[model samples]
Every structure is written in structure tokens, then in C-alpha cells.
Target chain A: MALEANYGMVGDFYTQNFTTTHTGDGDTLILNLGPQHPSTHGVLRVVVELDGEYVKKAEPVLGYIHRMHEKMGEVKTYLQYLPNMGRVDYLHALGWNWAYVGAVEKLMGIEVPERAEFIRVITCELNRISSHLLWWGAYLLDLGAFTPILYAFADRERIMDILQMVTGSRLTYCYYRFGGVSADIGEKFISDLRAFLAQFKARIPMFHELVTGNMILRGRCVDIGVLPVEMCRRYGATGPVLRGSGVAYDVRRFEPYSVYDQLDFDVPVGKAGDAMDRYDVRVAEMVQSVRIIEQALDKLPEGPFLNPDLPDRFIPEPGEVYYSVEGARGKIGVYIVSDGSPKPYRLKLRSPSFSNLSLFAELSQGTLLGDAISIMGSLDLVIPEIDR
Target chain B: MATLGQTIKSLWSMVVGMKVTGIEFFKPKLTVHYPRKEVDNLGTYRGHCDLVAREDDPLTPKCIMCGICVDNCPSGCLSLTMHVVGEGKPRPAGGAGELMLAQEVILPGSIKKAPPTGKAERVLDSFRLNYNYCSLCGLCVQNCPVSSLAWSREAYLVGRSRQEFEFDLLARLRAKAASSQGVKAA
Candidate 1:
């Protein structure tokens, strides 16, 4: 029943498609777009049936960069596999780490102090900004603009510097421990972060002035890839894509964790469920993240970063829990089943991009080829995150 | 027809874009000619590690040969050895100092950590950096508890000999301090 709900079969649309009762005969031409082609973003192969450039059907082919990360999680001890969490979606490494560490903490029942929770929220929100910045840059680059990428990187570099002082690594940070973060942030860390926040807040408006208002970008995005609010509900879509379609569902707001309940920030939504709306939603989210970072900083506390009761080997009781975070692309969920051992019994990942990509077919058909790529660009589908 | 209006609008947008880019062209070029530029300084953004020594305490006990840095090393590129007068490998009393095996290996996250055989000393042995495979990710340098191992700002690390790249980084650092002192005195 899950499989049936998860996927449905479709052929060339001649008004007879999805009508199981109809009987008709028509020629169907299969069009394959990249397992190796440049446009599908990163190593994604899509099979599309074209009625002369008007796509009648679309099917995405995946499992190219599948590294069996969940299986590896079950083998490695909690501390040992912390680094591997970053490799899932390298762009939003901090959010992924937050989810993994949050799950482990839940299983162990460790209460993080006020200071650590505040710090985690600040860092996670900063990471969310960085992720959104990269996505916006990449999305524009995909749409044939170059300058916004550099602008995005300029802002992203500040976040990297702020993170590196405490986390020690930039791109892939193995900073967060099982119970809490490894090191206590120093004076320099907080000061530098404040400066970064001030500078970043001033620069965010430029992004709006640049692409969001650009006539070309608007014409390309506005009505393209219209995924209605109801379809989003059926597919269990989360994050900006779901929110963009006017569904008031956000993992951070719904399942508040790591001092998120303490801080106040608005979840931006859009009325029109189109490509432009998704773009607007993500940009607005960047502003909201800045707001969150400000609140977290203002209420910063002083205390221990790590839990006092943290064990060398984190062994959880025989139970299961699913922890999720609103990653850059969508909701990244980690399902862990522990048999009261050092390693997890069975681990499953509910990757957002994978489910997000599944909807590509619904949006792609009855659209031009250019519109399809535009939809893909707007979706911000990181192939590694999907393939993971 | 849709064709004439669309073409005119496209032409107008192109003109506006070109005008913007044209104004940018007059402004001092932010376009960095990365390959052509001679100034190798990466400007305050951490480029490489410099080994410094204290002036007052000539031989400022910089490293006590504690295995903290060794254990913390993500890649096996860092190595340190403390001399014990006359041990397995003799110390040269005069001239260019004696060559002895070290305690720790400080590698730049270039290679995976070889599981330590329980029999081997907890201290560093010899830091063998396989430069052939080094991605220069700088994880080892960051994780190095002592803050010794570093990403050489010398962007071009394509060395001729593997041995030339593979140095006793800690000893070389200490020796570098000593030689700089000698130059200052002279």
C-alpha cells in the first residue's frame, strides 16, 4: 500500500493517461535526458516521453552515487559515524549534524544546558542561511546568471569564517558531539559572529535588488512548475517547497528542538505554488534566519557546551525515534532503531530531495524542455542528497 | 504579431544589461587574474602555518612530546620524537645533528589512520605524508591539538621527490626556529 501510494505508473498522455478504464492506441516516443548529460544538474537521468517537445511523461532514474550511508551508520559507533553525517548533503552539513546529534541525544535522554542550546540554534540558523545562499546562487547559475553566485559566495564566506573558529573545519564540520558540541566558544567567536551578523544583515537586501526583482528571472519562474497545495500534502513534501504552496507545515515549527522553542521567527509562505514562489520563499527564509540568529545571539547564555553525563560509548535503550530538520532543499529525517547497543540496529533516511525529485515528473509533463530545467533549478535538488 | 513585440522587449533588456556591465567595466577591475598575480599572500584569510620560537626562553619547551596532538591528528602526517642522550639511534654530539626516529606522525588529512598495533609506542614514530594523494582539505592541521601541522601557503606543492614533501614537520619546525636565531645572532 505504501509502495502504491509512493509511486504510480503513467504512459504517454493522450487524455487517456491515468484513466485505467479507457482503451486507446497511440505511438509513444521515449526521450532520455542525461545519466551523463550536463543539464540534469548532477548525474541524474530522466526518461521523458515527448509529443514534439511537449513532455507527455517523465521518469527520474536515480541510485548512481548511492554509498549505503544508512548501512554504514548501523556499523560505526555513535562518535565514529559523526563525520559521515556531513557527507549526506555537504551544502547543509550543519543541519544534517543537528538532526543526527538530536536523534542521539533523544535516545540517550541528555538535556543540553541553556548556553549550548542557544549556540546550537545560532549555528544551525547560520548554516541554514549558508545553505539557502548556495541554493540561490546555484539556482541563478542554472538559469544562466553568473554575478549572483559571486554575491552569494561573498556572504557565505562570512558564515564559513564564523563556523571555522569554533567548529575548526569549514565545508564538512564534525563539530557537534553526541550530547552537545565538542568545544566551548571563546570571546573572539562571539564577537566575530556579531560582526558577521551585522554585515550580513546589511548585504541581504542586495540579493533582493539583484535577482528577485530581475525581469528575466521573474518571466522564467512566475507560473512554471505549479505543484498545487493538495499534491504537496499527498507526496509529504516539507520545507520551502511545501511552504511555498501555502501549507503551514515546517519541521522546526512543528517539532521544535535545540532551543528553537525559546527563540521567535516567522516561517515565510507564498500563495502561488509555482517556481517563483519557491524562489521567493527561500529568499524570505534567509531574512527570517537572520532574524532568528539575532534573537539567539541577544539571549546568549553562559554554561557548559557538553553534557556532564555523556558516556564514552553512546549506547541507547532498545527503542526507535525519527529526528528531522528543515535542510536547505527540504526536510532531512533520520530514522534510528537501537537494540541497546553501541551501533544502531537498522537506520533509514527520509531524504527530502528524493521525494522532491519524484514530483519532477508531475511538473515536467505538459511543459517545455526549458521549463523542465527551470523547475529543476527552482527545486534546488542536490543530486548527492537525493542519491544518499 | 507576438514576434515583433517580444523581439523589441528582448532588445531593450539586452541594452539595459550591457549598459550595467559597461559601467562595471570602467570601475577598477575586481576580476582577479589569479594565475598572473605574483603576490602569493592570501591576505588575512589563513593561508599557511609559520613555526615561531620564543626569544626569552631560547629553547621554549614548545612540545613535551605529549601524544594529544598525535591522537587528535585526523590524517597521519604529524610525527614527534624526544631524544634520550644515547638510545637505539645515537645522537650526533657535533656538526649537523643526528638522524633519529620520532614519536608522532602529523599528516594533513591526506591518508587514512593506520590502526595502531598495541605494541607500537603511543608517541609519534615517523610522519610520512603521501603528497601524491593529498587533497589539502586541512582537517589534520585544524584538529592538531598543538597547532603545528599547517596548510603551506605555497599553493604549488607539486614537489619532485616524495621524501622532500615528507619531512619530520615538528623537528623541521624546531630546526627552523634554531636557524632563524643563528641568522639573527650573525
Candidate 2:
């Protein structure tokens, strides 16, 4: 109705797909997984033509949760759109913010100080842990386990409290300025963070004992929705999903932005790239995050929180840059095109969830209905991140 | 032979997970009583923005209408106009003037105010702030030469109409002054 009557939406919607081609086949039955179904997650609708619970053909319909973040970035200034970055993925909020800001800084040649860099790394790692924790809980909940969600939330609240002290806001923090951070970290902030680290370390082993080795969880996840190592790279899957497929690639190690080069941490990988491998990789990654946070705290430097000499209005030289960071879900990146203006000429967010979700078509094909939801949970799709 | 060994390894891991969840099922719940027990650390960053007083010098920063704060403002929320009582014809502040010095003068402080050294150096007669476009990024507070401006912790700034978002900067100053006077009287 909004468009010219002559103009119409096309491609996947209008075209006759594989299910329709094989519509008369006696073995296949078509099933719509959602535009409202809980298992599909968010407003995602998957039209799965099934052959007795085995997905014969899966066509995922997008644009239901589309708020058009890229379009909004065109209208707003650099500082004006900082709040909208948080809306992209509220769970991995800090990670997306870090990637967006990191890209702009790179393009503009803004040098973040050692102290600010360390703080960024510490906060980013902590947020990664929080994101994974939520995923762990939600994955279990999707698999018919409710108690773990409450357990995960308890741990997540501790991380939120620590972040709130320095950032001021809880969910969406516009803490990172163009050059550096907004506020200085106090003595209380460090001590409180240290306490969280200790508690988190003690609790991690318990997670493995509770969920990792559970008979039911193992039975459900192990060898289910197996994505081969080749498929992970071909589809550009990231974070634990890529790591689970035995890829040693990590953006932090590869690019070395912020203080990531100074810090020492290991990337956890798995041999078989199954649902269980994804789950195990995430659990291990959380433990690794705790290690990184502890290292960052010990090496915390005393200096100016923000570069005091930065000009009020920032205009980067006309250039395009692709900067990425290992976020909770995957490698969140920003493809920024600057035309020597305070506002971006074109800002395209390369959302990891969007790329990670593309693997669904290949992986979900042979999996059962119940196992499909398990695979989706294991992938940990942040809907807004993909929509953005 | 390899398949059997792999199956045994999987079984062992399953047993480990069971041990952990089983232990949690017995542990006492660490739930908080929301209504009865209130957390004291709710507004940790609140009430930090108080007008810093320079007691020794009376002329330090009472209020001077040098629009440094107004100029640097991202939201364009501040407007300031000054009136000078000089030994000249009564007119607007920016008009031609050879001023006679008064005993007391409103000078813009270091935070939100800058020293008004010009001929039109005097108290702020009027001020305005359009809060509609203000996302409260705290750039205004940081840029204020004299620290008179602030965001209140009472962040319920949502209003039904656009007019409600526009605040009278002078009115807020007056209210603050009146409250201070009341406190002193008490």
C-alpha cells in the first residue's frame, strides 16, 4: 500500500520453491514453523516441508522484525545514533556498541589510550559471558529445562551491577565516546569486579557438572544438527558456532584491536561441530572470559580516561573501513562509509547473528522437529542483531 | 571398537552434568524479597550535580550571561540574555553602552559560566531549555564553563506534549535559589 501500485515485493515470496515443485510427492508434508511460534525464536517464520519430522525443505521468511537500522543510521549523526546500536542486540549490547565505535575510531584514526583499551576489553569480555549465560539458560528452557534460566539470571545480574557502576545505565550504555571512555573507573569498581570474577570462577565448574555432562542434554544434543567444518567457513558462521567446527579463527587474535594484543587468552574449539560441541565451546569460552577479565584487572593502568584534546565536532576523512570484534553471538562488524561528514554516508552493520543464521538451511534439513529447536538455541540467535 | 569407546566417553560426561544439576536442586535458593528488602545502591550516580560554591569571592559566579554554555550545547537547550544597569539610556544588553560599575554583578561560574569580562557583564535576566531533542548525553554538563547545569536523577522526563519537554532554565534556577534560602532560614 505504501509503494507505487506498480511496484511489488518479489524474490522468495512470489517464486515457486522446492516444496511447491515436490508438492505432489507422497512422502512430503509442509509445515509452517512460525511467524508466532516460540521455537522459531523472534518473529522468524520457517516454512518446513517435512517428510515424517525430517525437514525435506526449509524456507526461512525474514523482514517481520525489520526496523531498518541501516536506514536510520543514514538520517542520524554519529553521536545521535549511539543509543540505537544498543537496540540491535540488547543482550550483547556492549559488544555491538564496541564494534560500532571501534570501526568509527579506526576510520577517523582516533587512538584510544592503553587504560581505555584495557577497560574496553574487560567490559567486552564480561558482556560476552553475560550473553553466553543467557544463551545457556534459554537453550535449556527451549529443551524443556526451566530452572537453569533462573540460575543464569542470578549470575547475569551480578555482571549488570558491575557494569552499571561505571556506565551509569543498565541495558544500553553510551559509555564509549569517539576518542575514549566517558567516565573514569573508581577503586570500588575494581574491587566489586574482582569479587564477581571469583564468584563466577567457582560457579563455572558447577555448570559443566549440571548441564554439560547431563544424560538427557547429551542425548539430545550430541551428534544432532551436525554442520561440517567446511560449511562453517562457507556460510561465514562465527563465535562458538565457528569454533565448534574446529576453526582456530578469532577476530581478537587475528585483528588485535583495543588492548586484545596485550591480553592473553585461549580460543576454545571442538572436533565434531555438533550441537553438543557448540554448547561445550560456549561453556569453555565463558571460563576463558573470566581469565581475560582477571588479567585485564591486574594490568589496569592509571591515566586519562578520555583524550582531553579531542575536538567537539569530529569529521573523518572520506574513506570506507571494515572493523570487526568477537561478540557473544559471533564476530560483530561495522562496514562504515564516511564522506568527510560528522554523520556517515553509509553505515552497514555486518551482524554475526545474520550470517550465523544462514547456516540454518543446510543444518536444519535432516534434523527432527525437536532437534531443530535445540540447534537454533545452540546457535544463539539475537533477533534484533540480525534485523539490524 | 572406536564407536564403543566414544559411547562410553559420552556416558561419562552425562554423568558429570547430572551431578551438578542435582547439587543445585538441594542448595538453598538465593532469591531476594523485592517489596520488603530495598537495595540502598539504586541511585549510585545520582545527586552528584550540585552547584559548587565559591564562598570567599562574592563575584566568583553568581550568574553572568556570557553564552559559552549556550554555544557548546549539543541540544541547543540553553538561551541566556543579560541586562546591565548602567549610567546610559535603558536598552537591550547588546545595544551601545558605557556602563557604570554596580556593587554586585552576576558572573558566569567556571562550570556552566565563564567570567563575563565584556561591558554587558551582569546577571542572567532570562534563560530557556528545549528538552524535546535532549537525549541527556551529559555533553552539556561537561561543556558548562560554570557547573550550573545538570540532569536530575528523577529521570521521568517523558511528557504528553512537546511543550512539556521545554523547560524554563530561569525558573529552575529560581526554584533552586528559593529552596536554598528556605534551607538557610530553617
* Index of the highest-DockQ prediction: 2
The residue-level lDDT of candidate 2 at B60 comes to 31
lDDT of 2 at A8: 59
Distance from true location, Cα of A285 in model 1, Å: 0.3
DockQ of each: 0.08, 0.22
Model 2 over residues A171-219: C-alpha lDDT tens digits? 7665777677777888888999999899888988777676666667877
Question: Candidate 1: misplaced stretches above 4 Å?
Answer: A1-30, B1-124, B127-186
- lDDT for model 1, please: 0.69
CA deviation > 4 Å runs, candidate 2 = A1-29, B1-31, B45-145, B155-186
Question: What interface-residue Cα RMSD does candidate 2 give after superposition?
Answer: 9.5
Tens digits of lDDT, candidate 2, B1-186? 999998888788767766676877898876767657655554544322223233553223344444544544433455556666644332332211212111111122322334545554365566666665554455545555555555455433466998886666666656666677789799
TM-score of 2: 0.81
